[model samples]
Target: VLVIAIIAGAAYYMVAVQPFQRVILSVGDDSVKTGYFLKRMVASQGMTADSVLQSLTAELIIRQQAAAMGFPAVTAQDISDYLRNIAKGENETISDADYDKWFQERLDTTGLTAQEFNKVIEGEILAQNVQDTIGAQVNPQVPQAHVWIIVLDTQENAVSAKARIDGGESFDAVAKEVSLDTTSKENGGDMGWQVPELFSTQISSVIDTLDIGKCSDPVAFSQQDSTTGTTATSYLLLMVSEKSAAMQATDAQLSQLKYKAFLDWLSAQEASTEIVFHGLNGS
Candidate 1:
């Protein structure tokens, strides 16, 4: 009986204690053992084992941030709606039994119980809400360049127009006569209170560099060729009539800038967060 007990204890050590005692990886307080980690790596199919682990760690951090941001609680309806949205996107009018089967399959693939998966989904929803809220708070202060523009279809025409202006031809007359921009040509190319931020980066830079009351030389610009579906270049003649300091951003620009602010905020959070990974590759 003593020898049998000894054998049983040795078998237990070989099967359970020897392999799982060592840490393969960790994300903050959460540590993964070698056995479980290797299984996860295999389940990833093509994804690198380290990347999969890191992604999960980042999600954990995002969840913590979500909690601190006072995001609204995730309800059962939220999860149900999320799944229903998935169904809609997939264009599959699935039955309740089908959904249950899929959900169970997902649990099996993810190696998570229904409760754990629910928590993960809840955290995801909360994190998304927090990100959106932060993005909505971006109020970009953008300057308005009240400039007159003489847009031309080609550089040669634009250059000739500039030269004509330099040779004492009235800019207003030349703009009305030669500017291709019908929108502003009638008003003598008065591009009334142009916000550089609402335009392209190149146009913004050009606008920023122009002196007040100075006329810019013909600047080349590009647009997608609507007719031939190719690259098309144009020229612009800008005269900075009036300029103002930063003002409220336009709707589209505000949305873009706000999203950027949210990303920047999230990037900044990494330094303050306490995250550690202990693994053969991540120590």
Candidate 2:
């Protein structure tokens, strides 16, 4: 009986506990074990499992790319400095004893050991470092397009609107009469100076490529119907009235572009990197 019990326990460990230590997410050669992902799910209160997985994936990619980009390494001292800044009084850093007490409380609340929590802090540091580095590259002046749009409920309407503009009818008059977009329609379809990143994927793809004063063909956009849970497609006709090679970006536009730059880099990394998901759904 004793021998049988020991064998059964060992089998259970192999089936259950061992799998948690196995890699579940991989980016290049870097990986996150299932155990670490679960721990993060616990630490990240109220986040869904899928969201936790995404956060870990982003963190791994950031750490990997940061190293390749020659960004400064995060150290134990750096973690301590982060703690000190947070625990500082009006004039001075917290004393060692107080710092210890606060740190212990944090660990107790999060249910993570020092090592795991330090890894979390290191992830935060690396993310902020990357964001700052990317943001600094966004210049105050960037290429922009002065655009007008006519939003219609169907492709036929969009095509007709484009034809009207092509056949010497005033765009502003047609937009005022037929556009479904109330705000732009009220403004004579003027979108003002715009960055492509601020629009939909379809619109952005053609916005920079269209010649000045030329109208685009119908561009389709899809949205889900909230009441009936069905997808509905709409169409838009775009005309680039002017283009600027170096238009000044507003603070809001700069912030948006900076964030987009980070996402774009991450997307490129994901495309080039060999990322594999394993052991999910018991496979």
Candidate 3:
């Protein structure tokens, strides 16, 4: 019985403990390279393994767990939807095949397989869903407004423009003839459908105090033009065209907020989880 027990212990040590130790030691020896790899994986919320074989095993485990939970597996259609959303945000376009090839190339560069990458993506989606569930309770409504603005290079110009408007010159004509924001000048300085939150609290307060169709006193704003590499202070004349009541938050938006809260909770949970590193000697 003693000999049998010894043999069983030897087999377990050889099969599991020995290999795990060897690979971990190798990672420690190449700590700089391994650290970079681990950092990247951590940033993406991916499991890190000391070797490629361990990485493959970890990926399989993640997939199996996800499947057991009936987590939606990413398909080509899902990838396409993801890409389309990204393109919409960036105002760019790429063919589906092109995106697929590019994605594969990135995985290869990062030493990740399709299954591993898919697992990471699935985890992200699940986390988002969890957040959505938690944030759903807060119904936030953002007030929308239509505004007309006249921007001038200096406070003096702003005061002069306001004086001219008060003197009965047409606001639209004055904006077109002299306002600095050329993009809005053609449309009579109309900035359509802006959320009140888009402006600073002070600016929003000022706008809230003014009645619709009334022009404001000159307000100073500082900005930099990246293209021209120019920095300047400007004064603005704002006219509120309309102020609409805040729109109720949709279910989807509420879910998104919940998901953010869940992530915060998850971070705290991780902090409390135990972590053990063997053979590093606190290095």
Candidate 4:
């Protein structure tokens, strides 16, 4: 029985422990071993063997699918650019020594070789490219609306502005006179034609419920100050002028759709692929 088990283990290794095999998450002619993922996940994240294995499996699936889709490969320059971006901070210039030390520390902590780290970066860039490509292709007919907006720094000012509008003042006039968003204020607060997504979900949901050419009462939301990293509650008012049932998708919206599309595609892959998770519970 012992000899038989040893032979079975060797056979499993021969079949599944390769980067170009029809096992685990093979795509076209590529695969990854269970050990390969376990090493990186355990070393870098301090994750349990089982959890790391699950993540690694999902990661390879996406990368392999991206490769199969013929997405552009990550270049050496791309890796360098990514490292440089990592070294950047809000207001600091990282020296070469510091960057090198930081990079090595990450490798030491994660139990990843430099080559392995490069491959990881490459996989990320490729996956992003795939997502962008799909998103660019997604042309969801987005609903659009025309509205006048008034943004005030203080609740007292917002209440005062609402009072003026309630007293039969023009929303356009009020917005242009007191709005804080300089660009929109210049246009008399006219947001020509916009998707509901132009604002936060709170504002958009409210807009969806308003009647045509109707005004929304002052709604409160918070804005973050980048320099100070502080949040401030602000007030907003909107008056709808026109709307469309569907229009071209914005880049931001397209980005969201693209990720969804990739997820859907990956799910489809799962259906057709043969995956065996040895020793993983409830897999």
Ranked by TM-score, the better of candidates 2 and 3 is: 2
lDDT of 3 by residue, 45-65 (tens): 444344432443333333444
Clashing pairs in 1: none
Q: How far off is model 4, as Cα RMSD?
A: 9.3
- Model 4 lDDT at residue 215: 65
What TM-score would candidate 1 get against the native? 0.51
Error of 3 at 10 (Å): 29
Task: Tell me the number of clashing residue pairs for each predicted model.
Answer: 0, 0, 7, 2
Clashing pairs in 4: 19-31, 44-110
Instruction: Estimate every model's Cα lDDT from 0 to 1.
Output: 0.75, 0.86, 0.62, 0.74
Candidates sorted on lDDT, descending: 2, 1, 4, 3
Question: lDDT, candidate 4, residue 216?
Answer: 82
Q: How much is 163 displaced in model 4, in angstroms?
A: 1.9
Candidate 4 Cα errors over 4 Å, as ranges: 1-113, 133-137, 250-283
Q: Which 10 consecutive residues of model 3 have the lowest summed lDDT?
A: 23-32
Candidates in order, TM-scores: namely 0.51, 0.76, 0.47, 0.54
lDDT of model 4, residue 9: 90
